[model samples]
Target: ASPADMAHIAAANPAAVQGLLADLEAMAQELLAYRADSSLDTAGATIRAQAARIAELERDAARYRAMRDGLVSGDLENNPIGEAMYELGERVCRERGHDAIPTAAEFDAAIDTAMKQPTCTCPSGDGSLSWPCPQHPPEVT
Candidate 1:
């Protein structure tokens, strides 16, 4: 383009220029407000803290499902081992901490340490009373 054409495009009434500048300033202010998320600054720390905690919870859940899966597929002789694992997981949560996420190895070690020869009773909540309980009828109870 010619210099003259450029000058013409750049030229404008002083009042119009002021008006345009004011409009742009207003738009910039609006944009700044939007960037801050409305009329004022937001509570970013709280929002992020809660989200981080939720992510931790999700990880904990994945770990828990992994533990439950072990119980679902077991020795086939009986589910006592799995039930013991479940009780162990709950105990770890209560004693160790709610956020505790036990690994399979941790569970395996616990189960191995606590496993007892089947007492011909059941591992249900009330094993002593439910010795011949219908749930897990003993072979020779």
Candidate 2:
């Protein structure tokens, strides 16, 4: 209705106008409540996602720590190759400082390269057989 018509009706029936206003106010309050509930639902989902990500990160960190410890202690597989690699890693760390500890991927690559090298039967001048054939040492690249 036009403003003029509404004003005329309101003046003629003030009680009806008051009732409509009350209904409109209640509808506005309900809409506000619904909006607040929707926002809370969205926030809850975000919090859940972040919590899951944190848990995943914690698991990854634990696995990495275990791998690092195994590699450093030469107890990963209790084999010759593992012992050689651990000794080599220790020597490198001693020479280059602890900050030079290789990541798991780098260590794996080095092991793969060492395994691919041909074995040598000839003993060194010191009467000891070193890893990676000694004569044809695995390239560091």
Candidate 3:
């Protein structure tokens, strides 16, 4: 999280204690998976990088756990963004059909689309959206 986001949280007084806890749990699970894989047959640079990432994730999860504990014990207002993030994370964990983990085909499609220069196929057909179609000059980056 950026300092600006932290400041916003403080200002918004987000009552995101449960959300924070959920985030911590999710991160812990992910880190555990990384740790397990790294400890197994994996070797070389990839394993090293995975181990390092897990370490960082563990540290971060600790921070969030502390924050969740603090929020539960302290007085705070509701943090919409935090709650939304938690809900999204929980939804993913539950595997609610809304967001199933991408399979190889989905991943390949994403890569293919990303690699292709974005084409604007909007109804407007104005040359001001993407490229290789009609629109150009992307609206926002």
Give the TM-scores of the predictions, in the order they appear: 0.29, 0.47, 0.24
Q: Which 10 residues in a row give candidate 2 its minimum summed lDDT?
A: 121-130
Q: Give the number of colliding residue pairs in candidate 1.
A: 0
RMSD of candidate 2 to true structure, Å: 13.0
lDDT per residue for candidate 2 within 1-141, as digits (tens), equals: 999998897777979878889999999999999999999999999999999999977755654564566567865565445665777689779888987877666565555554443445445423344555545555621
Task: Output the lDDT of residue 88, model 3.
Answer: 51
lDDT of candidate 1 over 1-141, digit per residue (tens) = 899987766667677788899999999999988988843345676778889999977755655665556567775445555666777889879888998977777776665544434343444535553345656565534
Compared with the true structure, what per-residue lDDT tens digits does model 3 show for residues 1-141? 999999887756656766777799999999999998786746677779989999977755654564465457654445432443455556555775756664545433333333334456666665453474443335632
Residue 91 in candidate 3, Cα distance off native in Å: 37
The global C-alpha lDDT for each of the candidates, from Candidate 1 onward, is 0.67, 0.69, 0.59
What is candidate 3's TM-score against the reference? Answer: 0.24
Off by over 4 Å in 3: 1-42, 75-141
Q: Which residue pairs clash within candidate 3? A: 14-78, 14-79, 15-77, 15-78, 15-79, 127-136, 128-136, 129-136
Instruction: Give the range where candidate 3 is weakest over 10 consecutive residues by summed lDDT.
Output: 107-116
